[model samples]
Target chain A: MGTIARNGWASLEDIRDILYLTDARLDAIARDVPIRRWCECFDLRARTIFPRPKKSQAGVVGYDGVAAADVAALLIYLERLGYELEPLPLVERLMDVIRSNPYLTNAQLSVLWYERCRHKCEPLVLYLADAARPKLAETRRLRTTTGYTIEVATSADGTPIWLSASAPKYRKRRVSTPETCLQCGYVWTRGDPDSSAAHRREHKKRLSYLDPQPVVELVAAVAAGENTISVDRTSPRWKHREIYRRALAFKREFGYDFVQWQSDKGDDDPGAAGVLFCNAQNVIVGACAFRLREYQGRSWRALQWIWLAPKYRRSGILTTRWFDLRRQFGDFRVEPPVSEAMQAFLKKMGDESLMGAPLSSTLPER
Target chain B: MGDMDPAPVDVLNDEPHFLSEPEVAQALERMLNEFQRETDRGAVLIAGEMVSAQLAAEIRALAPPELRGKRINELLKYPGFLSSFSARCDVALLAGFIDASAHRSTVVLRRLRNDAAHSTDAFSLAVHRERLMQMCSLGSGVAASVSEFAAKSVLDDVVYRLKQRGMTLENEIGRNPFSSAAEIFEHLSVRPDLMAVLDERMPKMELAIGVWLLLGLIVHQGKRRRAERTTGDIDDAN
Candidate 1:
């Protein structure tokens, strides 16, 4: 089979040459995964070059019946939950978990790691105490309400070690700020044996708010510019045409006639700025698309873009460019901005709608 | 060359190929079958503890336990309870569950889903797709473009609606509203400012959605007002 292009574009030969699976492998894949469901969810056209299992007289069951379905569902569920299945970091973590428990299966180790994470608040020493066999003689050990366990010990010189199973690289923690006892309002300062009792009594509430204001200042560049708007195709939000809706809305409200497409073979003529500007460096903004002529109807021009950078927007540069456009194109016959709100705002600012010009047949799109 | 058509290619090419509808449908059927199989056998049941506790108490009460702990847990793992399936069902299953209280949300959701379902019909998905295509200006393959756009829209709309209602629900509980339009906007996981920051920042359609949100907020606020008034009256009487 011909090699298939990863981008979905392929010649007829390319389609015919790639490794075309027989009906059996396709059947296996289809039977095992919700790959079709996933494809449909993402609006992809999928084809199975395979056969499927024949329907049997099985009773209608809800969410139970097959392992294949569960795995497929799990894959999709993980995707929906924003879990990066293919991320190297996650794979590395999974490997680490497996290595930590050499005897545990991947699934069991994963479950244990997740379950153990739930007890993150407990100190490592306390965990050691719970699991380790206690010494016959009384010794310093961490204890919890559940029970006492063996604790890691330090040598006479205080090497800070855990010798039970010998996990050296994984264990490295130092008490920075001493714990404080809330009941008596005493700090566990001066690392002494007596401070452990006080440390056990302290319980400080961890504080975190949902959304906080940004610490960095938002930067602005130039305000009003008749520049074309370009966006990355792979942008998460733009992939769904959200920006188109917003741009259309902006046009409708500001009374700008935005051309959906440009002529495939047009010259360097500026398409339109929708709005005009009196000054070039700092111009008032306009709403939609615009077309212009500089040399007495000879040089047909169009200002093709509107600057959308934050720096310009915040400083009201776009707004100013729009107002300036009115003055620059006052002599030439140009479509006036006709958004009710825009008109009112402009009228309030003493920019009246031209009296003699006929309103265009095309209405500002909503 | 004049009369006969060209011969069809024999081998599959290396180019990316999307599955045909029939292929997709068959695959879905097979997946459903497999799903049924995995769920049939008992899995690691976690919610069994709850059932066991209840069963223990019932035994002490001199009553026979209704079902085994495992049986109760088996019921909870139904696809309906899973968050991903729940989201799908929210839009797909709404036609069946629509009621007086949820009618409005359901109607809006149905319309959005309808738009999504008929995405290929240019006229239907035009409004949504054009926005993504033009804004993103993807130079990649059409399938990739569509996939990216569709995926983003699903999450964006879900999170947007959830956060919006979540904020309202939270405010009803006598807490400071930790959410604003921005938070909901962020929850949509898209830049809120970009909608207006386009070179030709047009907000007419957005303004309509804004109007809808504003109306919803007004009603929500009105409910709060009535609630506050009743509490104030109670305080005054006391």
Candidate 2:
């Protein structure tokens, strides 16, 4: 096989090259784990090279048992990511990175980490908690009774830490300020811990009237002249198209469809927002696809995105940029089945229909 | 070169939306107002809106067509029993519009309101905040969204059940009242100021449904009046 290009998924040849292994050794490794599983770690599940598991009376099993070369390609991906391709559980290795890095702060960084690891980090913490072990708490991803998704990480002392998986590290933002809690019916001042505490007591016990208020001082953002464009499977720019493909693959894991892709082309609908991220130089850095659907009898825009590229990763630029899209879309909605990172961001932002943060009136020439 | 086509991406089976904390709060207010209005309907019934047989018919017209012919005179005539807010809640719940949780909260709110209404002492939401929070929290299933976490919509649940029933049932002319009701309700949710004209908070889904029902009755009544006048003219000509 030809040498793999940048942003190309691992091919069997690429895998063999990365492992520097004899074809026989690669075969043995393939027998141990399917290459598709490995590619999934890198958010490459949508690629054609990915193995499709065969149907048998033994029941539908994993991806069509992968080739040695496929496994080689996947290992190469890990090595490039600086994650050793040892036989250790992938999640453990991911956790190792997470534990050592200590800087997955804010939505962008945290999300970027997940992207770098291949959107496969969830399984690391998966099944960690079981009913029998009080200390080993399996985190439930179910929406709260009030409808928000707050994935609380607990301290050894059993206190809930409002860990921010998304943007704006909420290390201590857990006191339930009035701007944050959607499940309660009383008014509490934003950022006032005392009022928040009092509100929580009333909320947990169930007292008060529903107080609805618009968000105060939402930040304005402008990514418009930033050279954004959508990508499809046919796009020669592998990096740009790969983001949307990964999103489609992710949705499939949850058993549903997201933005339509007509073969390698995008869905016919113009409303479909697909992997749309480019810099002023028109360099691809990210992807975002959204559409307006009838929600509860009203038109609501659904947003799904991957702002995971290195260029936009560290700073809060991607999130703030994504927020800018809402200005073009007046009061677009954000909904469920969101990633842990997105959920944390939504929790902090207070789940109103996002109408892009307003652009700063102050001038800084581009 | 042509590449193999990728499968079309579509929104998944999972429902996704973008309701903020304030929107959820607004939705909750609409729901509480929904419960309160049912009680208010009973109070208004006591105020003798039922004195006009036409008004009674109009209220019933909002019901399924089969129930539209049923005389509401007896329901209207019962002053104290029908006037009780809890009784009204039971009717809405039993009508299959609200869930068990809403039924229970309505009864609880009725008692709380009664206490406030009957108390000689000055009633303050400030003093009652804790107690009110505890009571409203039961099935209200809401959390204060000042700063902790955000999710849930009191309005969604309220309207989901209502839409399920309303969409299936039609008026005398066979029009689904649910579409009109839902559109109007959605309009109201976005307009807090419009909602405040009647009350500081918007009235709930029930009131919007109520508007549709009353409009149907008025339209039907006008048609009947016009038909009668046309027949009388023919008789005069003969």
TM-score versus the correct structure, for each prediction:
0.18, 0.20
DockQ values of all predictions: 0.01, 0.01
Q: Which parts of model 2 are misplaced by more than 4 Å? A: A1-243, A246-262, A295-297, A305-307, A310-312, A350-366, B1-238
Over 4 Å off, model 1 = A1-65, A69-270, A274-289, A292-337, A340-366, B1-238
Error of 1 at B119 (Å): 60
Give me the displacement of residue B11 in model 2, in angstroms. 76
Q: What would the per-residue lDDT of candidate 1 be over residues B1-238, giving only the tens digit for each residue?
A: 4888866664665322223334333433443334223221111011112112222222223211463455434433454232122232233224222122323332333344444444454232234433323322222353244444444543454345444444444444433222454654443234443333322222122212222222232233333444566798799999
lDDT of 2 at B220: 44
Give one digit per residue, the lDDT tens place, for model 2 in A1-366. 222322223454455444545334545665676655555654434244443455754444332333322333344334333333442232333344346665653322332344354422322221122443345233334332222233555556664433212212213343443464556445787677788788788675331112111110000001101122444343333322344454544444355655334433335554565655444323334456666465344555556444444324555656666556645544555545566766666666665334243222222211
Q: In model 2 chain A, which range of ten residues has the least summed lDDT? A: A215-224
Query: Per-residue lDDT for A219-332 in model 1, tens only?
Result: 010111113232223322321132333243344334667732232122133433332111232222222344543443354323333324222344555455555455444422
lDDT of 2 by residue, B1-238 (tens): 8998886556573222223234333433443444444443343232222112333333354454454443454464557343445555566456543445444544544555566567766544334444334333432234233111211233344345444444444432244433555553764465443333323112222222222222232334433444565798799999
